[model samples]
Target: MLRRLELLKELLLLIPLGKVTTYSSLASLLGTHPRAVGAMLARNEDLVVYPCHRVVMSDGRLGGYALGKEFKRRLLELEGVKFCGPERVCKESVVDLKELLS
Candidate 1:
Protein backbone atom coordinates (compact mmCIF):
# COMPACT_ATOMS: atom_id res chain seq x y z
CA MET A 1 0.00 0.00 0.00
CA LEU A 2 2.85 2.37 0.82
CA ARG A 3 4.52 1.59 -2.47
CA ARG A 4 1.30 2.25 -4.34
CA LEU A 5 0.94 5.58 -2.56
CA GLU A 6 4.53 6.46 -3.44
CA LEU A 7 3.92 5.67 -7.08
CA LEU A 8 0.80 7.84 -7.06
CA LYS A 9 2.74 10.73 -5.61
CA GLU A 10 5.33 10.36 -8.33
CA LEU A 11 2.57 10.48 -10.92
CA LEU A 12 1.38 13.77 -9.49
CA LEU A 13 4.73 15.26 -10.42
CA LEU A 14 4.02 14.45 -14.05
CA ILE A 15 1.30 17.08 -14.13
CA PRO A 16 2.73 20.12 -15.86
CA LEU A 17 2.53 23.68 -14.62
CA GLY A 18 -0.62 25.55 -15.64
CA LYS A 19 -2.26 22.22 -16.52
CA VAL A 20 -4.50 19.78 -14.68
CA THR A 21 -5.76 16.17 -14.88
CA THR A 22 -8.86 14.38 -13.68
CA TYR A 23 -8.94 11.75 -10.95
CA SER A 24 -10.37 9.34 -13.54
CA SER A 25 -7.55 10.10 -15.96
CA LEU A 26 -4.92 9.36 -13.35
CA ALA A 27 -6.80 6.25 -12.30
CA SER A 28 -7.08 5.06 -15.91
CA LEU A 29 -3.35 5.43 -16.34
CA LEU A 30 -2.52 3.94 -12.94
CA GLY A 31 -4.85 0.99 -13.34
CA THR A 32 -6.64 1.90 -10.14
CA HIS A 33 -10.02 3.25 -9.14
CA PRO A 34 -10.64 6.97 -9.30
CA ARG A 35 -11.44 6.93 -5.58
CA ALA A 36 -8.05 5.33 -4.97
CA VAL A 37 -6.40 8.12 -6.85
CA GLY A 38 -8.27 10.65 -4.72
CA ALA A 39 -7.38 8.77 -1.58
CA MET A 40 -3.70 8.82 -2.45
CA LEU A 41 -3.84 12.53 -3.21
CA ALA A 42 -5.54 13.21 0.10
CA ARG A 43 -2.73 11.41 1.88
CA ASN A 44 0.00 13.50 0.27
CA GLU A 45 2.05 15.16 3.00
CA ASP A 46 4.08 17.64 0.99
CA LEU A 47 1.81 19.66 -1.25
CA VAL A 48 4.67 21.69 -2.72
CA VAL A 49 6.60 18.60 -3.72
CA TYR A 50 3.70 16.40 -4.84
CA PRO A 51 1.29 18.98 -6.25
CA CYS A 52 -1.92 16.99 -5.83
CA HIS A 53 -3.88 20.15 -6.43
CA ARG A 54 -3.49 19.68 -10.17
CA VAL A 55 -5.92 16.80 -10.10
CA VAL A 56 -9.57 17.70 -10.58
CA MET A 57 -12.80 15.87 -11.43
CA SER A 58 -13.59 14.43 -14.88
CA ASP A 59 -15.95 17.30 -15.65
CA GLY A 60 -13.31 19.92 -14.84
CA ARG A 61 -14.70 20.62 -11.38
CA LEU A 62 -12.15 21.44 -8.73
CA GLY A 63 -12.15 18.54 -6.31
CA GLY A 64 -11.11 18.28 -2.68
CA TYR A 65 -7.56 19.18 -1.61
CA ALA A 66 -5.63 18.45 1.55
CA LEU A 67 -5.50 22.13 2.28
CA GLY A 68 -8.91 23.25 0.93
CA LYS A 69 -10.70 23.31 -2.39
CA GLU A 70 -10.36 27.08 -2.74
CA PHE A 71 -6.73 26.91 -1.80
CA LYS A 72 -6.23 24.24 -4.40
CA ARG A 73 -8.00 26.42 -6.92
CA ARG A 74 -5.81 29.36 -5.98
CA LEU A 75 -2.63 27.35 -6.36
CA LEU A 76 -3.66 26.28 -9.83
CA GLU A 77 -4.57 29.86 -10.65
CA LEU A 78 -1.11 30.96 -9.63
CA GLU A 79 0.22 28.42 -12.08
CA GLY A 80 -1.91 30.18 -14.74
CA VAL A 81 -4.71 27.61 -14.91
CA LYS A 82 -7.81 29.44 -16.02
CA PHE A 83 -11.22 28.60 -14.56
CA CYS A 84 -14.21 28.55 -16.89
CA GLY A 85 -16.63 29.31 -14.05
CA PRO A 86 -16.67 29.72 -10.27
CA GLU A 87 -15.36 26.20 -9.71
CA ARG A 88 -14.87 24.71 -13.15
CA VAL A 89 -11.50 24.68 -14.85
CA CYS A 90 -11.17 25.54 -18.48
CA LYS A 91 -11.11 22.38 -20.59
CA GLU A 92 -8.02 23.42 -22.52
CA SER A 93 -6.05 23.61 -19.28
CA VAL A 94 -6.53 19.89 -18.76
CA VAL A 95 -3.71 17.64 -19.95
CA ASP A 96 -4.61 14.62 -22.02
CA LEU A 97 -3.98 11.36 -20.18
CA LYS A 98 -2.29 9.86 -23.28
CA GLU A 99 0.27 12.64 -23.23
CA LEU A 100 1.19 11.79 -19.69
CA LEU A 101 1.69 8.13 -20.51
CA SER A 102 4.34 8.90 -23.09
Candidate 2:
Protein backbone atom coordinates (compact mmCIF):
# COMPACT_ATOMS: atom_id res chain seq x y z
CA MET A 1 0.00 0.00 0.00
CA LEU A 2 2.82 2.40 0.78
CA ARG A 3 4.40 1.70 -2.58
CA ARG A 4 1.08 2.19 -4.33
CA LEU A 5 0.64 5.44 -2.50
CA GLU A 6 4.05 6.51 -3.66
CA LEU A 7 3.20 5.59 -7.22
CA LEU A 8 -0.04 7.54 -7.09
CA LYS A 9 1.78 10.44 -5.53
CA GLU A 10 4.38 10.38 -8.27
CA LEU A 11 1.83 9.99 -11.04
CA LEU A 12 -0.14 12.96 -9.78
CA LEU A 13 2.87 15.15 -10.36
CA LEU A 14 3.14 14.00 -13.97
CA ILE A 15 0.01 15.74 -15.21
CA PRO A 16 0.85 18.50 -17.62
CA LEU A 17 0.18 22.20 -17.96
CA GLY A 18 -2.88 23.04 -20.07
CA LYS A 19 -3.24 19.38 -20.98
CA VAL A 20 -4.74 16.20 -19.58
CA THR A 21 -3.87 12.49 -19.54
CA THR A 22 -6.01 9.40 -19.56
CA TYR A 23 -6.39 7.05 -16.63
CA SER A 24 -5.05 4.10 -18.58
CA SER A 25 -1.96 6.02 -19.58
CA LEU A 26 -1.24 6.92 -16.01
CA ALA A 27 -1.80 3.34 -14.86
CA SER A 28 0.54 2.08 -17.57
CA LEU A 29 3.22 4.40 -16.27
CA LEU A 30 2.95 2.55 -12.96
CA GLY A 31 2.41 -0.88 -14.46
CA THR A 32 -1.03 -1.17 -12.89
CA HIS A 33 -4.68 -1.18 -13.81
CA PRO A 34 -6.54 1.92 -14.84
CA ARG A 35 -9.17 1.13 -12.23
CA ALA A 36 -6.48 1.17 -9.59
CA VAL A 37 -5.33 4.60 -10.65
CA GLY A 38 -8.91 5.79 -10.66
CA ALA A 39 -9.38 4.41 -7.16
CA MET A 40 -6.26 6.17 -5.94
CA LEU A 41 -7.26 9.42 -7.55
CA ALA A 42 -10.69 9.16 -6.04
CA ARG A 43 -9.23 8.81 -2.58
CA ASN A 44 -6.67 11.55 -3.04
CA GLU A 45 -6.48 13.99 -0.15
CA ASP A 46 -4.14 16.60 -1.67
CA LEU A 47 -6.47 17.41 -4.52
CA VAL A 48 -5.37 21.01 -5.14
CA VAL A 49 -1.75 19.98 -5.32
CA TYR A 50 -2.19 16.73 -7.21
CA PRO A 51 -4.62 18.15 -9.79
CA CYS A 52 -6.65 14.99 -10.27
CA HIS A 53 -8.81 16.85 -12.74
CA ARG A 54 -6.13 16.36 -15.36
CA VAL A 55 -7.01 12.66 -15.67
CA VAL A 56 -9.61 11.50 -18.11
CA MET A 57 -10.72 8.31 -19.85
CA SER A 58 -8.52 6.64 -22.45
CA ASP A 59 -11.25 6.87 -25.07
CA GLY A 60 -11.29 10.63 -24.60
CA ARG A 61 -14.21 10.47 -22.21
CA LEU A 62 -14.42 12.21 -18.90
CA GLY A 63 -14.97 9.36 -16.46
CA GLY A 64 -15.61 9.40 -12.73
CA TYR A 65 -14.42 12.65 -11.20
CA ALA A 66 -14.36 12.69 -7.40
CA LEU A 67 -14.49 16.47 -7.54
CA GLY A 68 -17.49 16.34 -9.85
CA LYS A 69 -17.45 16.04 -13.63
CA GLU A 70 -18.18 19.71 -14.22
CA PHE A 71 -15.33 20.70 -11.98
CA LYS A 72 -13.01 18.49 -14.00
CA ARG A 73 -14.20 20.10 -17.22
CA ARG A 74 -13.73 23.57 -15.80
CA LEU A 75 -10.25 22.76 -14.57
CA LEU A 76 -9.21 21.32 -17.92
CA GLU A 77 -10.71 24.26 -19.78
CA LEU A 78 -8.72 26.64 -17.64
CA GLU A 79 -5.62 24.79 -18.83
CA GLY A 80 -6.66 25.32 -22.50
CA VAL A 81 -7.78 21.74 -23.15
CA LYS A 82 -11.00 21.28 -25.04
CA PHE A 83 -12.61 17.98 -25.97
CA CYS A 84 -14.05 17.61 -29.45
CA GLY A 85 -14.50 15.35 -32.46
CA PRO A 86 -17.05 12.57 -32.58
CA GLU A 87 -15.06 10.69 -29.93
CA ARG A 88 -14.37 13.82 -27.86
CA VAL A 89 -10.57 13.69 -28.12
CA CYS A 90 -8.83 16.68 -26.64
CA LYS A 91 -8.73 19.08 -29.58
CA GLU A 92 -7.25 22.43 -30.49
CA SER A 93 -4.87 22.11 -27.58
CA VAL A 94 -1.31 23.14 -27.35
CA VAL A 95 1.43 20.61 -26.70
CA ASP A 96 1.03 17.94 -24.04
CA LEU A 97 3.08 19.56 -21.30
CA LYS A 98 3.40 16.56 -18.99
CA GLU A 99 6.99 17.59 -18.27
CA LEU A 100 5.93 20.96 -16.90
CA LEU A 101 3.59 19.57 -14.30
CA SER A 102 5.90 16.73 -13.46
Compute each candidate's TM-score over C-alphas. 0.93, 0.79
Clash tally, candidates in order: 0, 0
Query: Could you report the Cα RMSD, in angstroms, for every candidate shown?
Result: 1.1, 3.4
lDDT of 2 by residue, 1-102 (tens): 669878777766766677777777777667789898889888888888887777777767778777787777777777778778533446444233333445
User: How much is 94 displaced in model 1, in angstroms?
Assistant: 0.3
* Candidate 2 clash pair list: none
Query: Model 2, which residues run further than 4 Å from truth?
Result: 85-102
Error of 1 at 72 (Å): 0.9
Per residue, candidate 1 scores C-alpha lDDT tens digits across 23-88 of 998888778899999988887889889888999999999989978888988899999999999899
Per-model CA lDDT versus the true structure: 0.88, 0.71
